[model samples]
Target: MILFRRRTLLLSFFVAMLVFSMYLMMSGNYPKVIYRDSGVPDAEKVSTEDSIDSTDIESVISTNGSGRDFFVEYRLERDRLRSQEADYLREIINNPNASQESKDKAQKDLIALAEKVEKEMNVENLIKAKGFEDAVIILSGDSANVIVRSEGLSTKEVAQITDIVTRTTGLSMDKITIVERSN
Candidate 1:
């Protein structure tokens, strides 16, 4: 029947889009190089003056009162809220008293949420793999906002990020906004 064929076609289209987006994210055009400074010295023996206090190190590593901490906390909070939403949706789907229409809507919403999460993660990872220290992307209704860990972004960096977001979310370059958060 036409309806069955149409559904099949749509499913195929979505699958292809997913595959293409993943390919773009994993492409060798951008090399993956992670730069990390452990902040530890090579010398095992340390002078008393040279050794930093444990409390000082805790302050440095603590997620409180720091600019870089914002990203980690934000991600944790976002994930928590998303988990709550997903649980509610699952509840609605499982409730025997729920209307079929409501259950169907909840299922669609859950699927959409999953897709959005995937796209956001893909964009974030691609941006970081491109050499950013950290990045966060929120894909909301026709627009994406990207925050990167840097003092500022060069034109080329902006273009690369825009390309990743647009390709992953299928949004226009104009719909993507890139901002920097200095450490």
Candidate 2:
């Protein structure tokens, strides 16, 4: 009878301990704002899984790369700057003081640059839809640099990326470089 009582007491204590532990785990320093919507439609929100930060990105690059990180944000900022520059150039061309030759040149450059940037953004989104945790594509003069978060990559994965980028940009494989991001 004594042994039975002791066993029951120990079991009760363990159950209490488990509940306490779970309570502690459930409580954290972060606020839970994921489900609350403040009037904007879901489609308009960038939804880079705004909850994730950089360190989280480095440690756990999930299969989905839509999560916002340094690279994604940087790409966004770069795109905004490019758009602004084009707008500024348009203003310059519209200025009464500008020469006709200058306006013509600006118009041509803007058309070419706009097309390239738009293509790059489209390719980036296509790659992201493939389930990469985070992807960054930088298009320089002749080649493109792509960085993706993943523990590792197989030849097939690289080939998949090449296929996507090629289809979007019409760029040959030689000019496309696939790079895996490291901590």
Candidate 3:
């Protein structure tokens, strides 16, 4: 009975987090990306390259305001998505009518989800410790995307970030794509 109550509390906390994140996303606190039909040819559109220059970011930020932090918004969105996934897993685990097999799978998934969250947090902290102003990392299957808050990254800086990600995430250098988010 105590265990069940604890699970209930945990579920409630996650639900609250999800709701708060959604509110932030919907409240116009962050810049919204607008797709417009400029007469520019598709071939002449903004480069979709990994390195997003300050000019690119400035144009995007111009729509809303200057004080927006891309890293913070990305982190909030990531947390919101994870929170929703966790809430669904919790529901499956807590459903009394769920079969044992389904509950077991849900429990396994939940543990994996927690581990992924912790690993991402650790990687972010480690990156910041390396003197970055801010960093956001997203790990998927065998690939990881590391976006750092900077106008540009030197070769050495890229090496440092790549090493940190490879060491922390066990992803090969080729599989990790590092990008710069200009402040």
Candidate 4:
């Protein structure tokens, strides 16, 4: 009888403990919760109404008044046209069915179109002509250098040719260098 009574008491104790644990969980007061502090500064405590001390307002005004916004828009348009022209050239070069004759004709047509565009836009004509060997224009430190490596042209002749090119391009004569290579 004593063993039975002890067993009943132990069972009742376990049930009470379980109910107490459930109540604590449902009430949400068993585990202490902690919150992290946000690192933002209080705007109300900071002063931001200070006046700027700068004496370049007049200079800024003068610089800003120099040109219309249309100038930038026109430059963007010109850049777009140049990009399109490059794409067209690439397409022409990559066409497998393009014969040598057709390619030559296409190149001539492209140059004419480019000249027309240059005249209309007041852009400098950078490329004059291309032959069996490439003609390169080298601009180094305010000097224009034209180098052609092909056929029978002496160093002196190349220099003279470069001078002529500089004169025709309206570039400074002192800044132009021409080099030619003979095969």
Candidate 5:
């Protein structure tokens, strides 16, 4: 009877151990499954390049928008600056309290500011060096009651160039006019 009881105890212990091991494996605590779908096929399977359609390639290209947004954003910013400049010039001219010396000083300051802005906007070197053939540079200055012509550049390009030149020249961005040229 003692021998039989000992054998039964040993068998029960083995069964419990087997159940625990199985539970661990099924519960994902143990790495039971060795293989998974890696998305890439094995050497025996056909490749993805051969299966993809031409339309998929076209779709990818179409999804990438062009530089139109950059151009528009650049234009709007330029126009805002131009308006501000006009308003500033008007204020200076209309101020009756300003003495002759003060007016002369203001005029000189405006010219110097415009020239500095123009020099900064001069991205001819950068545009040419960067190989941006589509780009055009335009310049404007603070000479009141005089029409200044840019080398056939669009008003937008002019403003953009002005902005760039001002930034490069460390002048106030608001004081400069940048415009874009339309081809």
Candidate 6:
């Protein structure tokens, strides 16, 4: 009976993973995790010392407005996931054993990823080079969002961001959003 129980658990785990991988392949945003909120308090933060300096962490949790660090971390994570999706597509495209249909789809996905990555990187670079402390640019189908880390923004600051985005993207006024996060 113990042996049978072990076999059943392994089979269930395999089936669950197969379903997950299939779902990931079909989605354009391949791996933005879908989590149902369970009302359980996180134990990690609860037990941690409160005096740790945030700048030391470097990646996330920067000192300043919590919202600023939030956007920085979100953009970093989103780009990473998109990169992984691109890798998966590239593998399929390069696989000699892949079906022609699968190869064609992978090729298309690769092009899409390339264009998106280029735009995102260019926008972020231009924004940061233009004096923003840090910037994350998210371009959707028709519009773009520029999330910047700063100590809030003034009218001149907003105009500067808008002008830079318009010049860089050739996007009209309504198509660009400039968000300032204090940090």
**Top model by lDDT, which number?**
3
Candidate 4 structure quality by residue, lDDT tens digits, 24-120: 4587532332323352324542223211112222222233332322222223333444446545654674578888776666555455444443332
Question: Which parts of model 4 are misplaced by more than 4 Å?
Answer: 1-68, 121-183
Candidate 3 local Cα displacement, residue 14, angstroms: 8.4
Models sorted by lDDT, best on top: 3, 1, 2, 6, 4, 5
lDDT of 4 at 81: 48
Error of 1 at 156 (Å): 0.6
Candidate 6 RMSD to the real structure: 16.5
The better candidate by TM-score, 3 or 6, is 3
Candidate 5 lDDT, tens digit per residue, 1-183?
Answer: 853564365446445645854684487532223223453434533222312222322332333243232222332333344435534644674589877676656555444444433442345434433333333233433211111223465656555555544555555656544333332
Model 3 C-alpha lDDT per residue in residues 56-122, reported as the tens digit of each score: 4343334324344567645644665676777788789889999989987987777676667667777
Better candidate number, 2 or 3, judged by TM-score = 3
Q: Residue 122 in model 2: shift from native, Å?
A: 1.1
- List lDDT for all candidates, in order: 0.67, 0.61, 0.70, 0.43, 0.41, 0.61
Candidate 2 C-alpha lDDT tens digits along 1-183: 853564365446445645853674477421233323353434433333412223332333352244434553455445445656666666866778999888767766655655666676677768778877667676665677778778898888899889988888778999998989743
Model 2, position 142: C-alpha lDDT score = 64
What TM-score, computed on C-alpha atoms, does each candidate reach?
0.65, 0.58, 0.66, 0.26, 0.30, 0.56
Clashes in candidate 2: how many? 5
Model 2, residue 102: C-alpha shift (Å): 1.4
What TM-score does candidate 4 get on C-alpha atoms? 0.26
Per-candidate Cα RMSD to the true structure, in Å, reads 12.7, 23.8, 9.1, 35.9, 34.7, 16.5
lDDT (Cα, tens digit) per residue for candidate 1, span 4-47? 56446545645675686469548753334332445342343212
Model 2 alpha-carbon miss at residue 3, Å: 94
lDDT of 6 at 116: 68
lDDT of 5: 0.41
Predicted structure 1: lDDT: 0.67
Which pairs in model 3 have colliding backbones? none
Q: Whose TM-score is greatest here?
A: 3
